[model samples]
Target chain A: MQTNISVDLGGTNVRCALVDENGTILSIVKGSSNPEKGAQAIVDKIESLIKQLDNYEQANAIGIVVPGLIDQEKGIITAANNLPKLIDYPLKKQLEQDLGKPVILANDVKAAAYGEAISGAGKEHAIVYYISISTGIGGAAVIDQKLLSGFHGFAGEVGNVIVDPHYEAIGIMNAGAAEALGSGTAIIRIGKEKLGQQIEHAGNVFDLAKQNQKEAQEIVEQMTDHLSTLLSTIALVIDPSIIILGGGVMKGKDVFLEALDQKFHAKIFDAMRDIRIEEAQLEEPGIVGAAMLAQQSVSH
Target chain B: MQTNISVDLGGTNVRCALVDENGTILSIVKGSSNPEKGAQAIVDKIESLIKQLDNYEQANAIGIVVPGLIDQEKGIITAANNLPKLIDYPLKKQLEQDLGKPVILANDVKAAAYGEAISGAGKEHAIVYYISISTGIGGAAVIDQKLLSGFHGFAGEVGNVIVDPHYEAIGIMNAGAAEALGSGTAIIRIGKEKLGQQIEHAGNVFDLAKQNQKEAQEIVEQMTDHLSTLLSTIALVIDPSIIILGGGVMKGKDVFLEALDQKFHAKIFDAMRDIRIEEAQLEEPGIVGAAMLAQQSVSH
Candidate 1:
């Protein structure tokens, strides 16, 4: 099996792993991303992590997943909330030159969907909608075994679809958007404002809800309602064979899934009730997805 | 080029056309779909139309475009809004038995989208989203030259996606949905409720708006906003290479298209500014789309 290195770059850290054809991680390494040190430092950190994987086997190809609106065709990182200095940087070319291998870059959430579609929970479904409910809501879709990157490579931005048109919020906060109502960031923002530090983490909020905390329960219920609304919209639009849910918020929240499913059923048209909603199988879908993408690129 | 017979069954009319492989309509025929005379009468009307086409040329395949939910695999017209008796009827099998040729059935809007994608406005685009803005909003999507019929053949039901979650009206009345805001039905509904019967018809509404009627202008602007919201959602989610706008409302209303485009651009994120929205080229996309489906079935 050909060996490749896959990296998941985020605000705080950069995680790299050597993966085989079967998506098995042979060796893993991590390094901190010091934004205070600047874009060159981040590049340096990524290079060091690539070096750690270099000892295991010569990397045939490298795949990097980053959080941002990426220009994949040009291999440029357009804008990222965390890595501000990396804007407009030709990341693939820089990484390829430094690592001495071809490098491919993609949005982290899209990479995770690719990972799930190729080897994780969505493997059995032909069409899959993969959503991550983490610090913020992010999504990507896989149809007929291929990632559906739209004309501008921003196809699965489901979180931005406004769900509450009456709300004063604009852009991603519009009424129908999943992020506006259900995402972890939205949850934290709403909780902090409404509950006033009653819940430290979103998980704790969910825990509080489970333990019968009235405010926390209402908040979680509202979040689930928002998720269901988004799911119903997805069902009406894509009507995928299966929907794979992941991210930090969904890791241990089975009841939330149930509530979402119930709400989805209640809201969706009669023609779209059979769609299966399931949890993601891969522990770290983003890393796995990056590896899978590298494997696909190499194979093709 | 093989000859195919395409039939578009509507509430009041049963339109038939003999089409060639190049999407040319060789001959056309029409008759009333008198449902009061029962399903057999409708079948007889279809057979008579086929006979009219039979006099001109021999048909190798037959395709029927029906309005409502269709069970494609089973050839069943599950439930139709206009033709009540079409429910649970084996449409394809019955048509094949009557015409003595292979028959294919698809939702009318999906057929129109397929037609537009193959030979109409979306010919060169990789992804095409066709929206039919007539009495009610209907939509279908073609991705990578393949029709996206979700797990249960209901993939492109974009009209059902909720546009206004706060609205009490169920089905398509939600504010954010294209049908709720821009559809002819919505216009009539709004006119009846807000402006009363004096302004009847979408043309008069547009005319009044053109003449600087505040109420009329507000009604149109609100509808455009709703359509923009839905289009923005579609842009963010599907990110089609080109969006083809068709249906009765768009055929003569250039101003609606202009307003829709402006509102769509304002709502969509900067990452998806490059997607081109255009008007559909097919004169009768439903009939042409039915013919296209027939040809695809034969080739496959």
Candidate 2:
């Protein structure tokens, strides 16, 4: 019956939830992160948001998930793009001091992977790799019920892996990065360039591909092929029991799923060819995973 | 104080050694695998080789490391090209019965990585990735003192990862595979094709590159660049504490080390830019690693 507070700290907003031991959210609260104001201000806002919950004081622990590099052992945000001020900031210590409770901090994607590994589509699998093909691709891996945070908590950054060395670079990402080739933003950009018109999102390209438009189909095929390359590389290296695919780009999965599966199977090593690729089941893996971490932390 | 038997099963030879608990080889025995003769014949040769050792009965356990796919849990060589007759053969069970001792099984590269992780350059780090850029590139990852054997034990098959979609395919490897670009075999093949002369080995290309030969330098640069891509992909995905580079390619490392490091650093993610890449230290990691696994099996 114990409760824990879970917070999904994003660049634009902070989502707080009071979740029980079983990962059920008893209550929820949300507020603007106001990143332009700075890190401490956002922390203060998170505090205020949590205060809105009637049972905040009763929670045994608090978990916070954030985008960007995190020093898990030190509970510091090492490098956050949107919340740059939080770099090397001891967010967990600050939150613990204010909340008067234990705190667990992790990368947002890793937390989501843990959530999926514990109770979602990957629950039955011992090794789970969760990839979110959203605005930009991101990934996380959970092995034996624990997230594999490499030397600096950077494990499972699969999107950064190059799929084509000749492709144009996107922002900080290198040329031919899986993100630049397969992510939602990449799809839309390629779609616009090919159609000679404005395309609002990746779904438009998927729709065109489904209609058998040559240019759109080629673009979609490239995207899926690059994604397959990334997936096969992951399979060759990690060979997880299951890979759970999610994120906004998957909304139009019907157009690419079968093609992706075929391409991935074709490229993967013989020994790892059988790994199942499935869709992520949890709707709020971030919040639930944060809560799961909090619960596990307290139990340990 | 106790000893274990280690066997390195390759396509060309069967190497057996009696190693102490600390991985010190107390006695050695080697023999031709005569692979074309069949699996049982190879097994018999291996057994006879072990019997030739004076410490055969004194060994507590046995560890076998193989090149192709292995069912480690069941101790079977599922599909080995050289030992095709061993397909689905219960090598571990048979070895245990013949040796009258416990047995452990693992992939050769994985065993080498475990050996390095336990006592080589990677001993200082918790996560270690060992890559052997030899005739055909191969890789293995050790996390927390254990090799990461994926669902079907295909973890760390990095050479199969495609680096270029447009490149010509080599043998069973897909087009643009890291193996096709960076492996020692690839270097020789490309050197002969470009030089229009019979280049004996990869060393000739390095020797030419060191002398600032344009074509040779280009070939070496391409190899190093592809290696950098592979290493960067590994860093982004696994973010190991340290990466250990080994195999025949390292013999010509002086020609490519600095350039490889630069290329790898340039492509790796910002958070993972500091990962240290080092050389493999173990002189006989295969035998030592097999022995280590043997000792661990009994201890477990």
Which candidate's lDDT is highest?
Answer: 2
Off by over 4 Å in 1: A1-4, A20-22, A32-61, A84-86, A94-102, A170-177, A197-199, A251-255, A298-300, B35-48, B51-60, B94-101, B171-178, B198-200, B251-255
Note the residue pairs that clash in candidate 2.
none
Clashes of each: 16, 0
Residues A211-300, candidate 2: write the lDDT tens digits.
899999999888888999999888888889799998899899999998998999889766566788899888888898899888888887
iRMS of each prediction:
1.4, 1.1
Error of 1 at A70 (Å): 2.1
Q: Which ranges of candidate 2 are over 4 A from the true structure?
A: A1-3, A34-45, A48-60, A81-87, A298-300, B32-45, B51-58
lDDT of 1 by residue, A236-293 (tens): 7788988888888885485477888888787766656778888888877788788778
Quality class of the docking in candidate 1, CAPRI style: medium
